[model samples]
Target: MAISDVDLASLLCSKICHDLLSPVGAINNGLELLEGETDPVMRDRCMDLLADSARASADKLKYFRLAFGAAGGFGEEVDPAEARQLIETLIDDSGKITLGWALQNEALPKKAIKILLNLTLIAKEALVRGGSLDVGAEKGDLGIEVVVRAEGAKIALDDAIRSALDGTIASADLSARTAAAWMTRELAVENGGDLRISSPSATELLLGAIVTA
Candidate 1:
């Protein structure tokens, strides 16, 4: 099933907007509190909250621009460092999820980068109780291999998202939550590759992609 470009655009927009809502709402809330708070200590606290919310909002926007928008200049390949930075910024907010980034490649095809970003997004979401997130990419006989592993006290991956990542989602039933995963799966398929997810238990998750060069 081919998704029209316009529909794809809409889905990507929805995903970005949805992810941003919380941080953006926080910024709004902080502003509202600041407007009425006259106490010295509370004003300082509100400022701190505003700063954190603003930073989070900026980080999310940066992640989404690379993951869903036309970024990385005019190049067909993107720097691995850039992707690492984006993911790092995202994890910085949680202050609980530790990131172990091991990228051996200097760069990868943009489509592969997109797949990596989306997979990272999914893995990050699965770490419900904060965990270790290990993300790496390497080249092998199988092609460009992107692997992400998340282990925590609690992990929760939606079945719908898993289905979307594995190209098992019914096209008519796709929703905002599965949009990024579905897009990742399609990109891998187009590149002669596929996506896989393994969650042996509630405490662990592993996402992998093998995209042919």
Candidate 2:
């Protein structure tokens, strides 16, 4: 089933909001506590919480801006370094997920960058027990190849998310949890490419995408 443009936009927006709610809420709560707190140590704790929440919110926004927004600027290609920084900060927030980036290209088309970021997000989700995520991209005659590998004590990818990434899910079944996967597949397909997911072991997940140049 084809999702209407309006519906797709709405779902994507919902996903973004859902991902940001926790940190934003924490920031608000920190502010509220700071306003009423009288003790110096508690006040400092509130400040720390606020700072951490603010940083998290900012990092998520930056990642989403490039992954799902037009903040790619006026360029047809984006610097891979920028995408790296966004993903690094995002994974760093988990404090359990480590990132290994290896991009052979200095710059990649915006579509490819979006696909890379979204795929990274999906792979990170599969790392249920915290893990190492490796992301790599390269341009070739066939097109641009993007790969993400996640390995941890426990890794799991939902069937719905896999269907969404493979473009087999019905529009009515789409949810915030799978929106990024859906969008990642759409981006690849729109550019004459597709995404792949592989699980060679219960503790490892691999995601790959190839977008035509």
Candidate 3:
């Protein structure tokens, strides 16, 4: 099955909106609390929550603009250090997810970067019980290879998401799994790459992509 660019853009936009709702909702809740509270300490807590939520929302927008939006600045090639920094910022702002990076090359194609970022997000989602994620990218004679691994005591990946990544599910529903899978598939196709996944058991999951040079 073929996916149109319009469909891809819509999927990406839907994904961004879905991710932003949490922090934005928190900010709104904090505002509501402030309106109801008279205590100075409670007001202060609300202010803190508002600030945190605002910053997190801003960070995600900035990252998503470059990753998914129409920003012409990111050329065909991306700086590895910059990419790593962006990913780190996302992980830090999102909270509770640890990321480890191992890049053999200093740069990679833009499509590969986007795919890797989406994969990282998926891996983070799988670690609901809190786990570690390992990300690595290397350039080979064939092309670029990226790997994302999540290991935890309780890993629960939605079946819809798995189906999307496997290209067996459509994106009409646009759940977290479907959105991530759609984004990953779009990037892979744009760069002539392929996404592969392995779920050996309930507690472990692995995702990888390879793009032809």
Candidate 4:
């Protein structure tokens, strides 16, 4: 049986929600604990945990909403500063990855921004062993080009993810890789563009998108 693209997209969204529920729920639980605890010291500590978890969960939600959901509301273009801030927050909250940006454009098409964010998430997942990620964009005579590269000690590019990027896997069964790939493809198509993916070695993965100027 085959899955419709809509269903696949829904499944991807579901997976994202599933992954996030834990930490978000923990934040709620911590808040409840803080409410019941009478000790000022213990209450203070619980409050700290609640605050940190809330911020982290919120940051992830913001990034994921833009990356996996709609592309509008920031207008037809996205401010590079906002994008940079969101990326920074995502890395900081995760606490296991580093992100470096070399953005040449001050603003990007909203669809392009979505693609970039999704690709960044995919690169972060690939760098499970702690590594550095480089994300940059350049403008050419043809259009805008965005590039994401991940390098680490042990990079594992999931086959399902590759399949999604290659348009061989249905979106419904999208794991991390597949969701990113699917989002990338959708953004490319929306912008009259295309995506290119390359994994030259076990520790390196590259993803790029080219869209009209």
Measured by TM-score, the strongest candidate is: 2
User: How do the predictions measure up, each by TM-score?
Assistant: 0.93, 0.95, 0.87, 0.87
**Model 4, span 36-155: residue lDDT tens:** 899999998998888888887888888888887774675478887788888888777657788888996578887778888888888887888878889998778768898999998988
The list of candidate 3 runs beyond 4 A from truth reads: 72-74, 93-95, 170-177
Give the better candidate number (2 or 4) by lDDT. Answer: 2
TM-score for candidate 3, residues paired by index: 0.87
lDDT score, residue 10, model 4?
A: 80
Q: Best to worst by lDDT, what's the order? A: 2, 1, 4, 3
What would the per-residue lDDT of candidate 3 be over residues 1-213, giving only the tens digit for each residue? 566677767777777888899999999999999999999999999999999999889888867776676444655677777667777887775476777889865767777777787788788778887767889999888688989998888788887888778777754655533765766775786677788889656788899998875
Show where candidate 4 strays beyond 4 Å: 1-5, 71-75, 170-177
Give the C-alpha miss distance for residue 85 in model 1, angstroms: 1.4
Better of 1 and 4 by TM-score: 1
Scored by Cα lDDT, where does model 4 land? 0.79
Ranking of candidates on TM-score, top first? 2, 1, 3, 4
lDDT of 1 by residue, 18-47 (tens): 888998898899999999999999999999
> Over all chains combined, what TM-score does candidate 4 have?
0.87
Backbone collisions counted per model: 0, 0, 0, 1
Report the C-alpha displacement of residue 111, candidate 1, in angstroms: 1.5
Candidate 2, after superposition: displacement of residue 24 in Å?
0.9
What's the residue-level lDDT of 5 in candidate 4?
73
